[model samples]
Target: MSRWPNLKQLHYLVALAECENFNRAAKACFVSQSTLSTGIQNLEELLGVQLIERDNKSFIMTPIGLEVVQRARQLLSETKDLLEMTASRGGSLSGPLRLGCIPTIAPFLLSPLVTLCGETYPDLDLLLREDTSDNLLKLLEAGELDLLLLALPYDLGSFHSRVVGQDPFRLVLHEKLIDSYEANPARYAGLPDHSLFLLEREHCLTDHALSACQLADQAKINPFAATSLYTLVQMVSHQQGATFLPEMALRAGILERTELVAVAPQGQMPHRDIGLVWRPSSCRVEAFAGLGRLVTSCLR
Candidate 1:
């Protein structure tokens, strides 16, 4: 018979590998530094390999140790999925669901989604995290988030996704900026790249809008980037410049009682497909699909 290191020890090693500091890893594992040290010792004794190179100044995982850490992460993620699957059974939308959403969509989507879950899936505890899509996707890959609510045409690695809604883009400007944005094609063409603003970098919305407008060479992006659509709306109010906004935000009273005017793009509308995404290996794929349907149904 051969002895094996426990899952908890693997967890400790993963934490150490990520943090690269014994003290920080111990804190993350919620154990004493000496306890974490002993766990690693046990693991090395069992595996007959020095997983980490120890030093007073720094710690480095060996090449094989790095591979083990990667596998450990995958193992922990699968274990979590199994536990969540077991909990999801025998209940109608019961148990916790950690969902991540991009900042642009959070304000418009989260409130109603929360209410809908409360009304329909009373047993479900929906935990929400608002962040950039890149950040959210990282969390999703790490198994920190079960699903993501965001706009698509994004690279989601191996995750599977379902379209829940579409948000068309429109050019938003102050009523005073242009006389009338009617059927005049010149007005659209004469749009100054310098007068245009965006929602800052790393926001997929900004990228989508830029691509749709063919404004790659337009260098007039605002020096100070707007953090939220509301901020952009305020800037438009002050006659700072015209910007692009999604149809959902505009429909949600974003332009209400404000002087900003939202007009559909001159020709074919530039729209983003909103989606719900999760790992295909997740046991809750069907469950998440149903949840996705539930979410989009409310949008109708």
Candidate 2:
């Protein structure tokens, strides 16, 4: 018998802890339920610890199990980093590279970035995930995502980041509203309550826009929120409310078929900085740097 629990057993334990169901955990680990159960049992016997309390329908991890799971996650992340460092010694970026992006930027940059990566690094298999910044960052920390392309000035904690470009904000409103504002310039500040719409609070873009465009008052007016940029645009088209759109969205022709107008906000225009971020321990810094240049060119 080995003196320490093997990595495979640690992996199973972590997967079970995360999925909370033996069947689902087994599926996630790409193993049969019986195999997964036996592996956990063997791990328990080897460690001489009761990791979980099993019931007919569900199971609960013991307190020690929870602590072990946390340690296991860190161990797994470091192990992956070690493997990556070993592979990168050849000085080539290949194999599966999982990348995550925020919802606001994904539609505009994902396709072009994919095309560029395919052309430039044919050996690299780029796997993309579009999610909220918070969720993507969580995935990055968990080692589920290799890198992230998200708006900057965010709290990235200890992760390293590089700015790629600036995405300026534009005030998007109904053409009629634009005309009304032009006719009555004083109405700009007094724009009707609930006349400003933005994404749900979970999206960092909402905070970014509010801070950058100084639309804090406008946000106070509306209890309503849109789930996506497309929904926000539709709401504006229906004369519901105005929104602050990133320059990349406008360049992508998001408002092309609508009567909506996108114009620079009054005073100096504010913008979000686009950036790429990764764990400092990652060995793919060069690859990420090259990707930053690609994203910059795409923004151009």
Give the clash count for each candidate.
Answer: 0, 0
> Which prediction has the highest lDDT against the true structure?
2
Error of 2 at 89 (Å): 2.5
lDDT per residue for candidate 2 within 1-300, as digits (tens), equals 558888999999999999989999999999999999999999999989999999888899999999988888888887897787677663466777889999899998899889998898898889999998889988888888989999988999999999999989988887767766566565456466678888898888888887887654553356778899988899878864678899999989999889888877754778999999999878888877877888999988
Candidate 2 achieves a global lDDT of 0.85
Model 1 lDDT on a 0 to 1 scale = 0.82
What's the C-alpha lDDT at position 233 in model 2? 94
Clash pairs detected, candidate 1: none
Off by over 4 Å in 2: 183-187
lDDT of 1 by residue, 1-300 (tens): 278668899999999987878999999999999999999988988999999988878878899899888888888888888888888862347789999999888998789888988888888899999999998987788778999998888988889999987788888987766654453465554555567778888888998887765555466566667888898888777754688898779878998888878776643767888899887768887678768877787566
The best candidate in terms of TM-score:
2
Query: All candidates' TM-scores?
Result: 0.89, 0.93
Candidate 1 local lDDT, residue 77:
81
